[model samples]
Target chain A: MKPVSVLKVLSIGLLAAGLVGCGKQETSKGELIVKIGSVAPLTGPQAHLGKDNENGARLAIDEANARGVTIGGKKATFVLIGEDDQADPKTATIVAQKLADQQVKGVIGHLNSGTSIPASKIYADAGIVQISPSATAVAYTAQGFRSALRVMTNDRQQGKVLGEFAVKHLGAKRVAIIDDRTAYGQGLADEVEKAVKAAGGGVVAREYTSDRSTDFTAILTSIKGKTPDVVFYGGMDPQAAPMAKQMQGLGLKARFLSGDGAQTQEFLKLAGPAAEGVSASMPGMPLDLMPGGKSFRERFNAKYGVIQNYAPYAYDAVNAMILAMEKAGSPEPAMYLPELVKLRFTGVTGEIGFDERGDVLGGAITLYHVRNGRWEVLDTVQGESAGKSK
Target chain B: MDIFVQQLINGLVLGSIYALVALGYTMVYGILELINFAHGEVTMVGAMVCLAVVGWLLGLGMAVPWPVILMLGLGAAVVACMVLGFSIERIAYRPLRRAPRLAALITAIGVSIVLQNVAMLVWGKQYVSFPALVPVVRYEIAGATITALQVVIVLLSGALMAGLWLLVKRTGLGRAMRATAQSPELAGLMGVNPNRVISITFVIGALLAAIAGVMVSAYYGLAHYYMGFLLGLKAFTAAVLGGIGNIAGAMLGGLLLGVIESIGAGYIGDLSFGFLGSHYQDVFAFFVLILVLVFRPAGLLGERVAERA
Candidate 1:
């Protein structure tokens, strides 16, 4: 072999390797990928609800990208990357870590309070802003993270309203409380207990149940023994519906009540005829009542042939995110964070504005009753009114 | 006493569904000794297929009666699950049959993951209300209220179990299955196609699981992509409790476990320590499994077989 031929071959090999490396680098550095991460229960029991929140965030990202938003004076498009936490806190933490590794600038999840409470710390430490469309735990945004905000109101306000409804509206002297023992369930239960006690109403009995359990005969029997006028359950619909049915089966005729977690068609299906007269307190007005929600509801019904729970809040969350981006004139988290904090925008649910604590300010909590297997709006009360009731 | 009877009936109804699914698990394990972790996902697929069929029938303006719908749904589920079972055996299990058990188990896990994600992609991660093929009307017998659907689930499971028992005991294929189970090499020498028997076992198991899935989706009125996970775990627990390789034992174990959980939830309330509520029902089942495994490793009716090695 000639020396010149060997040199030429070696140079060609080096050039090939360099080109491959450059190709990899180019693929990795495709124009500052500003990832908007979302965490939700994509695989477990609550996957349906979590997907709703994820879809809302995706809609916002899609709209932003379509319009070519600028961040840091450079045209940038938002990219959404989603992870399924399965509504588990540990899984949520892992998802948060993955997002951090990918260097996502912002996150628009997680749905469940139990998962969000721990996952938020990961985002906070990583300097990624997290805005949850659902998680209703009072402590969710209270950790003092400048970047944490929740589009939904806390259980504290919901609890107070429930207590007030029991006393002032239902004229109940005594109420029984039951919780499903999850963070969301127990937190709302505790708040309701406190508010009911403060309202000079007697809490005749308090009990707990598990989220996966279908039978509630024993708990209902115990509550029947107490003979309370009303029963407030702080749990999601899966357990709440069956609990309502079992309560009826056990001959406990106490009026059933619950929080936003129980506000769904699943509850009615589970409870069946037993669900009649049961009331639940939910954040924001019903879809038909909200001005923008009417069209959204029609479109959703047309597309899916069913009215979904939490669609209004989901729509509002996306609108709020988009409005904040428009106001900030950029997609950069650091640039838009302050603008998001100060922006007041009208959304499908209502006028969306966040307080310093990142809670929805001036939010109206509505009470609904299951009538003929449908959720019907009963009354709407503001946060201040709810607080006063407490 | 009446309340006890009612609770027992409820338990029996729920147990039959669990047992029906558990049979699939136990039979697959009896032949292949692999858990077939994707069995529950197969059930989910079956239920979803039924849902899609019903939706399509309704869309086509065909008022196909409830019984016809149910029959068609079950048939569709069976066919779909059989195809899935065959493919899983071929792609994931066959190549690794000679490999370590851990490899096969890992492959099963991968299959389960792939099926779950595929289900999510196809179903769109939402809970769709499954149509009620049977009237959900309730009937009171001796002061206990029971739904028509519950009765159907219980009767259908019993009939299927009987049919399965006869199939395994009376048919030549059944003899081959038994021979293979006893000794695969000996069965191969005796002109019994061991591989064919194994495939047949999977097909039967998949059929049972599909029936169970249809029954459950009808009972629950709602089905989701991940509905299989918890139900599969529960069915596995039922299988283990009854002796993993025992056919009839699985059915007995399922019924007993359901009754016990219901009774525990009913009497214990929030005061029965760990059995305070319904969510702790799984805990109760797990506790029973641990107790059973510690006391009777061969299960209640399970017979000890010679190790393959």
Candidate 2:
């Protein structure tokens, strides 16, 4: 019995030694490690776009790693730990707290405006830098959180551009507006309605639906009765695609317009031929036109097989954070955050800088028309650029 | 006037789907005195099964008639839902039959979550486009243009409901089902197989839900894992509106609810001076339910004692 007990003790000691040996792999001889947290709807309805945003951050970190970043006289390795928020505000706040607890040097994401707004408070309280890739709501940056910033242009700019395009370019005198009633959707729609009225277009009708609703037949019928020349929907692609198809089915002859949420390949695939003549907007320069966008797209297509919508913005977000950290000569959030607010760098999405409100400076909205079953850039309107041609 | 007719057509088309799903709720409540919250997930599974069968058959490039392929899809959906309904009863509900009502209700909720997650895994948690099997065209009816599918939905719903009414009133199986509902032990003593009768009743309800699910997918041209959640909720409201355990009441309740929602949405801005909009359509359904509960506690067609049930 004594001999058996000794054998068991030896085996246990050896197993524990082996397990300890397996955990830590040495890639750095005195190399400093910094983690950047990313949040998106990784497991739900918008996962395709969420994965695209995540891929952007991952690709940026890998490229940044290859360049061999050094801060505070120490070689640094950047890591991204992504959390799935389901594009939900509650989940966003919960994960925001978790990432703050993990002490990630900086953060990137909470992709929907609804989520980004709520989660920003948590990061601000924790003194962590948060850069949103694609939350375009006007109210997001308006909250005045020193730590909260976004790479993409907000809905105020997108809606103004879209409304102008519909009235002046499409030559529409009457417009109908519909929203999904989410914080993002309603905010965008209100802006569009305001812009439309300012652009000398008559508001014919207004309708709303829930995010979970599939049936829009009744609302479409009512909207059709108003006979507007253009109908704009402020919602995500899943609902937008079906609504587009239903509009055609209901014999509504008005042209369809939406913002970045409906401007996706999934919309083309889901809406089929109904997507042919629709118009939408994204909050950046066209990918091909941006200086770094071409190389980024090439590498991204090679790595992830597609660029949904926010990849370029996400890439810029990661680059912007790293630029701030490099400028500060530190990887700590508290040390780097002040520099992040004013850091100016040319990234894949364009020249990256922020104003007092943490909104991207010189923000632009790129208008797109679906031609030949693909998004064709119609115009690029930078706030300072005065209608640059796409 | 044309818009009003158009909305009415939309309401009826919507109502037909609601009526079919409501029957499932009403039937189970009639026979088992259980709510079966998992009933919605059963509908979701039915729709997904139909989509999967159709997609697989289309992918294989089989040169079959459209009608034939559609029939195969419906058949697949019905069978899958029946199997799911049976297992849910056997695995989740039967053991809890002798337990407290709260336990069974809690188990039903758990089963609902399990089905939703399992479906999310299988279907990939995104809105999948349900292909247009029918020709995409509309026919004008009284200044209201409606697709051929809408007419089919309305006609089919009426036929299904009528057939169900006849089956319950005039069939031997229906007699056994009613006997079991009245008193399971007494029915067993009277030589009726109570378990078998109950199982058949559950499957019958599932069959109705399955057909409704397929029609909804075709009508909307989209299907997702969570699609059944709201549809199930609306159907439950309809079930309660018609007296929880009544069959024809479910049909009437569904139609009335649909019309109310449609008209309420159409005229809400005018009614409220633009303070409220069509988005509040869901609110009207619950408001009616609350009003009915306040004024007529037994529901429109519900009896005081549930003696027939």
| Interface RMSD of the candidates, in order | 4.6, 1.3
lDDT of each: 0.76, 0.85
Q: What digit string (tens of lDDT, one per residue) describes model 1 on residues A320-365?
A: 6656666776555677789888877677666777888888876778
lDDT of 1 at B281: 51
Over A83-156, each residue of candidate 2 has an lDDT whose tens digit, in order, gives 77777799789888877766677888978888999999999999899999988888888998888999889888
| Model 2, TM vs. native | 0.81
Q: For each candidate, how many residue pairs have backbone atoms clashing (under 3 Å)?
A: 2, 0
What lDDT is obtained when candidate 1 is compared to the true structure?
Answer: 0.76
Best by lDDT: 2
lDDT of 2 by residue, B116-142 (tens): 999999998788877667777788878
Please state the error at residue B159 of candidate 1 in Å. 1.3
**Winning model by DockQ:** 2
Candidate 1, position A321, lDDT: 64
Tell me the fnat of candidate 1.
0.11
